[model samples]
Every structure is written in structure tokens, then in C-alpha cells.
Target: MASKLILLEGVPCTGKTSGARFVASQLRGWHKNVRLFTQESPTNPVDLMNYAFLTPEQYREFPEEDRVLFPVEETENPKGYMIPLTELHESLQKELESYRFYGCQPWEVERPLMLARWRAFAKEAMESDAVWVLDGMFFQNPVCEMMMWFDLPQAEIESFMSELADIIRPLEPLIIYLESDQIERRLREVADQHDYEWLDSLIAFHTGQSAKPNEVPDLEGCVLCLEARQLVEKKLMSKLGLDRVILKNAFTDWVEAYNFIRARVYEKTMGKPSTDK
Candidate 1:
């Protein structure tokens, strides 16, 4: 089968969001139904980015006044109810955000939920003709949890990835890793583009998750942490043994990068290079 699941992955400021948009546009141009899910997308089928997961008992006990304000989804296999954080009032969300399944929970609790979600997603993808473009769900998000949050060993992380690979193998997923050789420069550029608060928050989140927070005190330390992360991610990508491509981008010429990515996606999905461009 041709690839229906296209994953664009990389660290911050690597143009993953732009790559995803380009890939989806290219697929749509080919008359294919394409769904582009960026990292911040609330309705991503595979990852629980901004949603709060609650047990059945907790769901029942949730305040009726607050619960009636928004839609709720119940999953049987995972045996939980999901409520979007955006739907809840600020005070209520603050109280429940820790229950989020992605970054807030430990890997042991998050692993099964991740696997189950992927299984369900793969089944649905098999039934549809639409192509799904995910910005960071495949490697980036999982890597953040395994490497930064949990500090798991490479072998253990590989085992977790292997299970996910098995579930999505039927979809013929393609992983496109966008990377820059100048990690520090890239991070600084991103930092320059954003406000001080954004950079401060980013450094805090990454450093605060570190085993030795004192070691990563500033941007220089954060750069080292990102360098380590990118290395691990690339290593894992090579081990996945799936159809994958690594694009070296400087983020200077996005048009050129888009052309290359579009061609690669064409080759993977249609078994030929794109002729349109």
C-alpha cells in the first residue's frame, strides 16, 4: 500500500509546520483528500495535545454545571472520557490539566493509551482514502516525553517505538525529518522571532523536566539538550526501518525545501516523482 500517514518531525524552528502545509497542499493538488494536523491542532486524531482524560468515575463526578458547557467523548478501549481544555473554564482547566495524558502522566500510564489511540487511528485510516499529515506526533512528541520528561533509556524507548511502528506499518507511513546542522543558531533564530516570555517558558519546560535542572540554566544549556535530543531522534529514525527521509534545511529557502519534500511524498505515495512542479 502507498503511504497514507505522512509524519513531519523535527525540533523547534525546523519548519515542520510549513512542511506539513506543503505536503498537504501537494497531496490535495493530486486530487487526494488530505487532512493536515499541526502540532497545536486540537483535533489531532493520534495525539492528545490539549485534551484532558478522565476516568468514568471522575467523569460522572465532574460538576454538572461545568460539564454541560462542552462536548465530551467517551472511549471504551481506553475506558476514559476526553474533554478539551479549551472548552473548560480557566479555573476548571487548571485543576484538570495534570490529568492530561500526553506530557503530564508517566510513560507507563501514557504508553498503553498511546498505542490504543494509534491502533484505532490506523484502523480508520485503512477505511478511508484521505491522507493524514501530522506535524510532530510520530517522533517529536513521543521523543519529548521519553527523552525529556521520562529520561528513558534508548533501548526502552526503542521498544515503545517498535510497538507503535507495528500498528502503523499497515498504513505505509512515511517519516520526513527536517533538521538543521546549526542547532544553536536555529534555536537562537527561533528565540529572536518569539518574545522573551516564549523563550523563557520553553527553556523552563525543557530544563524543569531535566534530571539535573541546575545543569541546564540558560539558552546555551538548552542548546546542548536539544542537540542531544536531535541525535537520539535521528538514531531512532534510522532504526525504525521504515520508508523515511531526512531533509537538511537551513530554513532560508522554504520553496526549495517544499519542492524536494513534495517530490519525495509523490514518489512514496504514487510510486513516481511529481511532475507538476
Candidate 2:
């Protein structure tokens, strides 16, 4: 089978990570080369502090460029090169207080630069021989050769849909939307993990924004919900669709999800066992 690029897009708090993991496990079981990349970096407080320095309205109105980078300064310290001392100090205090809780060094506060780094990473992944399973809120960008949209409730996505559309347009890959109920349940399940509080907040905020009507752009690809997976199969019969893609119920336990994916892999590989074993 030809190499496939699967992008799983969803608001924060939605179960994209779990779903992506399931997909990756299934692909590996089928003996297809697969690599799963999820966004795991912590948000830098310096970046947030700088942005927050502006008046709330001003911050909201600031040009994307201004919001992304600091102004250049002639001093050797450089204007934007280092995180603001005050912000860094405050962040350090928080890190020290929550050192055990945080479990990682605080992220350096920088904007678009980090995003650029991630883009480079994705480019490298695309160049590899393995099937790529990217899970995140990567709005449809030119960098993405193919795309998938996880449809969730408008209440769940809030403003993120608009923000995402502004960066990327008309993705040219299969778009899969988990029904709203499933998406919500997944978020709740993730929130149950005590250590995932930050992730939970991020998801809740985004999902709330996505709920706004007309926020999400019209994407160019197949749209599948939890129930629609069956329909997708019927629609793609005889076509070289995502043979690697599998349908999973939102309510199903993780084990069932694993089995569902494994079954699809078995079908695709004609019962060939995964070589990884």
C-alpha cells in the first residue's frame, strides 16, 4: 500500500491523543510503517506575559507579528532574544513551587519561532518512508499534504475554528469528525487524569469556541463521525481510500477501540502479522 498521511484535528480536550494512539497501534499491527507525532511541548509563560502586557483590547487587536516576536533592541542583551527577566523570574517561582507537579522545565516564552520549529519537524517526517499519524490542532496548512477534521460540537470548539481557518485553507485529505457526544465524553475522560489539568483546560476552552456557528471553514475531504464510519466504508467501496483508517465508538473502552483498529488492519494486510512482533 502507498504511504498515507493521516492528520487528526480536534479541539483541545477532545480525545485526539487516545484516538491517534489507537490508530497508530492498528497501523503497526498491520505491519505498516507508522510514526505518531503529538504536540507535547509546554506553553512558554514569557510569550504569554509579553502578550498579556498589552491592554486586554490591545492584546486582542495586536498584529500577529507584533504578538509573535519582541521588538529588536540595540543592546547586547537583545530585545526579543531572551525571555523578559520579570516574566522569567515569576515563571521560575511557579516552577519551583510546582516542581514536582510540573515535571519539566518551564517552556521558554517565544511565539511563532516554536511553531516554525514544529513545522520543520513535520516536514522532516513527511520525507520519511513511514506513514505519518499527526495528532494536534494543526489547522489546514500548506505544510499538511493531507488533512482530517475531527468534527465536534460548536460549544466545544469556540474561537479556535476561526483561528485555525485563518492560518490554513481547504485541506486536501480525509476529514473525520467524531460526533459531539463522543468528543465531549473523551474530554471528560481525559480530564479525569489528575495530572492533565492544563490539557483539560486547553481542550475546554477550544471546544467552547468551536461551537460558534460559521467559525469553522469548509474543508475539502470526506467527513466521518462516530456513526458515519460505516457510511464511509460504503462510500469508499472499490476506491483506494484510507484502508488504514478504522471506525471507533466514542463510548467504547480503550481495549475495544484497540480491537476495532486491529480488525481493520487485519483486513487491510490480508491477515499478515505485524513485523514489529
Candidate 3:
């Protein structure tokens, strides 16, 4: 079979991580060569992982001249040079954070750089001979963040995603959408975690709430923005025409969601139900 990439995605607080992990576990249980790639997972497609981790301050601090590097290991692979990952991450952390630098404006630089990195990752993964179960896809990163960066219409965003789908089509993508009917309650559910500062920051940033008035966004505005973002995501992703398995409010209904996805994936892989789907 062709290499596969299963992407888990959903609104904030919708248990994307838990679901992705469980699905990957189930796939593995079935004796498949499935690899799970979450944001925190150390072993991931290097470019994608690095892009996800890039910070706003790091991006702003990155200098212009540090774009690409020339690695002279053999002294004559004239076409061979490295994009300095360490140097880039030192200033700008990941592709998502680049949105803070001015959204699509930074696309000119970020687009080529990240595209090259993703190609490297795709090539490497294809050769590694493992199916990828990614906790987040490009749609979640630069794409969702881009929605916030620009005043793009849903159609345009969909167009962008379609283009990306084509670029990574070699992996035979499968998107798993974990959705929720309880956005407000889910936010509170996530708030209950209350331990990690990163979680706090993520909540604040996603909700559009600034600590001080005029220092950040207003609460209501942020909530609406997030809703709009999720809505567009759901709509456009379906338009991508990739195989998809969607579960409603998977955050609260994990086991049901897990079983549903497990069965679907089995059927997809083997061309038959695992045990009466």
C-alpha cells in the first residue's frame, strides 16, 4: 500500500491529542507500521515539528542573511547546502508563529523555507516505510493561524489548503476531524487543567483575550474569531476531497470516537471490516 498520513484536527479543547494517540495505538494494535506524531513527540518529521515549535520572539529576532547555509562536506556537492535549523529556531521558532510577524506578508520567506523542509520530511518518511498519524497537520498550523493573520474569505483559504493537499498527496492523506457542539463548555474543560503555562497561553491566545485592555484582544471578539476559524476549517477540509472520519464532540466521547475511527481505519487499510464495522 502507499504510505499513509492520518491527521487529527479539531477546535481548541476538543481532545485532538488524546484522540490522535488512541487512534495510533489502535492502529499499532492491529500490527500496522503506524507512527504517531504529536506536537510534543520528539521523533517527528523534522521540518513539521520544528515549524510547530517556532516562537514569535524567535521569529522576530531572526536575521535576513541567515536564510540558507552551504554545507561543504564533500567539497563539491555544489548544489548541497543546509537551511540552518538551529539558527532559524533561535530567532523564529516555527511556521505557525511566523503569523505574528505579519501573516501572509512573511509567506514569501516562510513559504519557500517551510515547503523545502516539508519536502525533506515527506521524502524521509516515505523512505522510512511507516504510515504517519499526525496529531496536527498544516491545516492546524500556518493555515488556521493564517486565518487570524489575514482577512481571507473561506473560499480563498480552501484554495490554499487544496494546493497544500496536492503538494503532500504522495502520502495518501486521511483527515480525522474531532469536532464539538460544546465550544463554551469545552473551553472551561480545558481551563480546568490549569497547570501548564503553555496551556494558559494557548487558551488566552486562541480565545483572543488580552491580559490588559488594548494590550490584547477582547474576549467576545476572540471567541467569535475562533468559531469562525473552526467553521472555515471544517468546511474547507471537507472540500479537500481527502478520506475523512469525523466524530462529534470527541473530547467528551473518546472511547466511542476511538472505536469508530479504529474500525474505519481497519476497513480502509485491509479493504474489509476489522470485525463487522
Most TM-score-accurate candidate: 1
The 10-residue segment of model 2 with minimum total lDDT is 218-227
TM, every model: 0.88, 0.39, 0.74
lDDT of 1 at 233: 84
Per-prediction backbone clash count: 0, 15, 7
Assess candidate 2 and give its lDDT: 0.38
| Clashing residue pairs in candidate 1 (N, C-alpha, C atoms within 3 angstroms) | none
- Candidate 3's displacement at residue 194, Å, is 2.5
Expressed as tens digits, the lDDT of each residue in 169-220 for candidate 3 is 7777777887777775565556566544434455455543443332224434
Off by over 4 Å in 3: 46-105, 196-200, 207-209, 212-217
Q: By TM-score, how accurate is candidate 3?
A: 0.74
Tens-place lDDT digits, model 2, residues 10-39: 443445666667777777866778767655
Please give the lDDT score for candidate 1. Answer: 0.80
